[model samples]
Target: MSTLSERDSLFLEIAVGEKLISAQQAKLCKEFSGAVSENLVKNGLLSTEQVASLQQKVEDKLSSGNKVAVAQVEIYKEDTLDEKVVALAKERQLISEEDEKNCRKQLKKLYDLGYNPQLSSILYSAKCISQEDLMALYKEVEPNAKVSIVAKSMPFSELSLPTVPTIGTLKRKTRHEEVQQQESIPSETIHMLDKMEEVVSQISAPEIDIASEIAPLKQEEEVQEEVQEEVEEQPTNESVAPTPVATPMPTATTVTIPNFDKVLEYLENIDYKVTKLQQDQKTALTEALSHEEMEERFDSEDIPDELQRIIKRLRHVSEEEVQVAIRDGVGLENCYIPKMSSSTPIVVKKVNFTNCVIDQVDFAGVQFKNHVDLGNSRFLTKAIFKECHFVKDATFKSCEFLNGADFAKAKFDGKTTYNSSAFRRYVSFNRCGFGKKTVFTRCYFAKGVKFGEVEFTGPASFNDIFIDHRFYMEKCQFKDSSTFSGARFADIADFGRSKFEKETKFIGATFMKWGSFKNCKFSGSANFNTMNVVGDLAFDNSTFESVVNLRAISASRNISLQNIKVGNEAAFKFLDAHIGRLFVSLSSLKGHIDSHIQEDYHVARKEYGLLKNNFREINEYDKEDWAYLMEKRMERMEMKVKGPLSALKRFLNWLALDIACGYGTKPANIFVTSLAMLVFFAVFYFSSGTTEFVPSGELALDHSVKIEQSMSFIDAVQVSFRTFTNASIEGWVPYTDSWLNYVMMFESFFGFFVMTVLVVTFSRKVIR
Candidate 1:
């Protein structure tokens, strides 16, 4: 063995303390775990007390299930635990060249750790958990393992030979034989009577089992009493007799028919009551009626409640048929016969079109156990079941109506589907409740439809529905926002006249024609932000409770928002497409008055100024281009102003001057001559009368002498010129002279008029 130095012994002790060893690496480094003890015993490096401390630390960590590499332990030898690991690794040469190259890609430079701090921490923490786990992950990349498991055996096995159970065969009558037996029957057929009795028995409450146990004696007594009463009353009605009581038939007993015209007549004559007939009279009557008569009776509005009750009892009877008279103009009562219930779970069912015409249908009061299908059925022209009760699933799939359908106030407790139904005229479902997922997908409306107060308490979908005319859903409440995505309107659709009492959506809906949303009120959020309209979009007086999204829309004509109000942050945002024109009235934009409105006002004013300048510049160009640009400028200017009044006045003034210039007179000469004539006329009109006086000789001589004395050569020449022009010898006028005063008044008036004309002309040309 080589003699060890203090440094080597310390390094081995530290390596053991820090635990930087893998199991394989530990094989090479584990000797260092006790290096401090050995070194102290040999008096080589560390003191015995120091060696003891180091051993305790390493052992404690080992007992705690911690794995330490040799390098990590070595780190404790020279420096504190906070010292860098890479520096220690470099000093010790713990990694081989190939390992160093591989680790370099991940470790790289120290500063590079900041770029992916999360990834670095994950890699470092993973290594600290277990060296084996890190090595396995690295080797996964190197081996390119597919890492899939194959099935070891089959999950199940097939059975061997089986035992078959034997069933007893029974003899049954053939259809021909049964027909022959029915022909031999003479009196009221027992099959018809038995069926009628069964139907009547079936009419009782569903809890008959429990009720029968308590009232079995009472029920028997009541039946006997009813029988006694019927027998006594049977002879009173001369034309009809009661049905004879028959023995109880087996559960599967079949019924055969007999002509029921006489029995029907007897029942009708007695107002649908057969005194001699037992409780089974209902099934018996239906069995006697023919198919044609049954259809006619079912469609008739004149059906009495008692007759309907009998018809319903025999509706399912296989044997004896009944005749139901169906004549036009006859009112049918209780025509919406109650439907049958089965034990099976029905997801979707439809049984429409059984009757061509029905009136006074009372489905509003009945509960359906399963989906009710009513497609392509014609109801009476005024058929109404506005408040029907639906207990289970219901459907009106592809139903067509010739008259108005009133389904207002109906309650649907399950999913309802009305896909492809056509309402030829008005249909009102004002307050119906669709409790489950209701789908009106692809329904067509030829006229106005109202669902004003309908409550949809489910995920209602009107996806791709067609409205040929108007669809109004004012004040409608939806528990969840109903989707009208992909719906198409063929004509003017008015949603503004409707109310969405809750959140409603029309995302991606296509409005192919004109649409009006005037005064439609929303109490909750509405989303029509991404709607696609291929026609005019008008929203007058519409109020939105939440944000209105008109973010991205393509409207062919104008989008008029004359008086609409939105409650929250509006998104007329991100409109980068060509908007034909946006007409937002002043009052409607009140909320934006301080911001967009003010900004737009200033911008409009600036635009008008720029347009005016543009027009002026264009007029200086050649006629053709000037005309075109001027037209464009004028249009832009018109947009910026109330009207074309300012432009018209300027044009008229310029035209008048141009016309005057076209004539022969020089403009300056005409102006000067006109001014001179106006002055002469004013002088003539304002003059007071001229006065003549005789002068004394002395005064005249004095005047001549004074004139001679004042006359210089230039004065004499002026006097001679004045005389040649027939100048009058007029005396100088004083301030108080009448003619001079009149002249001054005329001059003042003329000056005032000239000043007024100048002011008016300047104002017309410059101010406006």
Candidate 2:
């Protein structure tokens, strides 16, 4: 009894020899437990159905006792056999050791270059061994001597057959009998019989010469003709009974043995044809089942009589007939069209309507299992595909829809593409669902298009698409990344209240009309980089939970970003963006707006300037002041410091314009600075005792009547105020000998400048 492992190994070896599995696959199968076919299926090396078929084949081969022949052929393909052949040939003195070494070196080179050449073939091609010597050596080295020769000599089917007698055997027997009956045999005849015996001995050899062996048969025929003539000349007295004759062997011309290479080629052709036929049958069966299942589903429903008639027509008619009906403007309404193929009607797989002109048709509730192509087709009237399901790739490349088209509530579970298609009238894909990557590249929509409430579970692309009418994609949900790169809108393009859960890009898109993304929500990065808008664009009340890139965006009209919310981790990139007018307020941003532009001063400066101008145009005075202050600050930061003088100028500019008065934008800063300066001077004058009070005489004008006492804080304040106002007080003056007089002049000059700025700012506010 064979062990399970031994049986599995035998089965796998046969499978490998039949090209069902590779030799490496067979080796891998042996490392695992269970039946070889089961292990192969488990490892995904072969399908379950394929393994079952292979098991059947292996069983048949084993029962037929051809396992050894297959196993020996597999061994001959291995490197171990190559080494054995070289060693046995050397042992027999057929090739020297140096030749063997050279052959090994050449074989290694061939192996390095990804070639798996046989050692016998290599030696024969290099003239190191003759064909006869190589074949004899292989026979001796191989475990099954007959397999070593017959495997190469004939096709696999013939090699597996049981041993049988050859035509040469009967010929040899007949020639020997003729020689034995004769008193004397010719020298040529004797030699020919000896050669015939040798040929009969090596009957399995493919190299046997039939032409040389058949020459003796021709001589025997000539001899028989001469004997008949001699017998006729003798003249028999009594009537002779008719003698029965033996059936002559077929001549070489009549029974020609096919060449070994041609036989192998013919066998390979047969195998290929059989495999193709099996695959075709399997496909046809699957398609038939699908059609029957769909028909059963419809039969169970309470549909109308017209719909039932249409369904029956669609099922019974051939694909060409349906195409002809479509071309003839037949209304195929409410029909469940089975999958169609033109060349092989039995295998109804893909449905192709390429370059056809179709009329009005409704394919409601149909399911397409394989590829559905309508490339270069023209739809003359309204086409409806409500609630249809595409189970594989669907293509509508270069199709023209002269009338409107509707695909409401359809489900696409495969890659869907629409390249260079045109819709002249209104089209809708509302409530459709996509399960894989969907593309609409270079499509043109003349009338309005709607994709409301669509669900996309895969990446969607609308690259280079052009819509001359309104485009609506409201309330849609994109679960994966999507792009609209290079798309152009000639009219309003609305994506209001949509949600994008992954990265969304609109790179290099152009909107000639208004574009809206109002109330949208982005859970991932939203890129509008290098976008251009000729009309107003709005993102009112939208939410961005991730990075938003608006780099190099150019809008000729207003861009409204009112009441938008951003996440804390979200960032905005407005690098080199040019907006004619921006409508955003501080209260509009509900979360942290990452507009920290300190890293790039040049961009920061431009961005701040744009904000300032926009705010001023909107007449939001407080926001304008803030934007103006930020602009000046960014400009000062951008200023390059060269020398000490330039550095001092920069610092002074910062102190005066930014810190002191907020670039004349903040009126409160000037008043605060003036009061602060007044207090400082007043404290200095009082603490230093550098001020005196002068009293006037009553009757006459006195030049100076000074009270040489310590000036109080009130007198110090009065003197500082009077000096700052450039007015003289009647009773107080700076002491002549004190160095505070120069301080007073400096304070007055600074006070005058501060007062001038205050007046100018106040006057401007009042005028405005």
Per-residue alpha-carbon lDDT of model 2 for 1-768, expressed as tens digits? 223554465566556645778877776766766676777777787887777776775565444422111001224345677668777888888887766665555555444322344555445434567645665666566635322211111111221221111111212334324433442434443333232232223234333322232222323334345435533643264222111121222121012222223322332332223344344433433333344444454555433355444445442434567655434434333233333322221212566656555545566777776777777766655777778888988888887777778999999999998889998889999999999999898999999899999999999999999998999999999999999999999999999999999999999999999999999999999999999999999999999888888778999888998888877767667667888888886654323334553256667666666677777777877777776777687788888999999899999998887778888987789999888888888888788662333422222223254345556788778778877878766645654555676999999999899999999988877776
Q: State TM-scores per candidate.
A: 0.32, 0.53
Clashing pairs in 2: none
Off by over 4 Å in 2: 1-348, 547-552, 571-578, 587-595, 641-647, 690-708
Error of 1 at 568 (Å): 3.5
Measured by TM-score, how close is model 1 to the native structure?
0.32
The per-residue C-alpha lDDT of model 1 at residue 764 equals: 38
What lDDT tens digits, residue by residue, belong to model 1 across residues 448-527? 68786677888889988888777776656667667787788877676546666666777778788777777776666666
Query: Where does candidate 1 stray beyond 4 Å?
Result: 1-364, 367-383, 398-404, 501-503, 522-525, 529-536, 574-579, 585-768
Q: What lDDT score is found at residue 765 in candidate 1?
A: 36
* lDDT leader: 2
Error of 2 at 103 (Å): 99
Compute the lDDT of residue 416 as modeled in candidate 1. Answer: 91
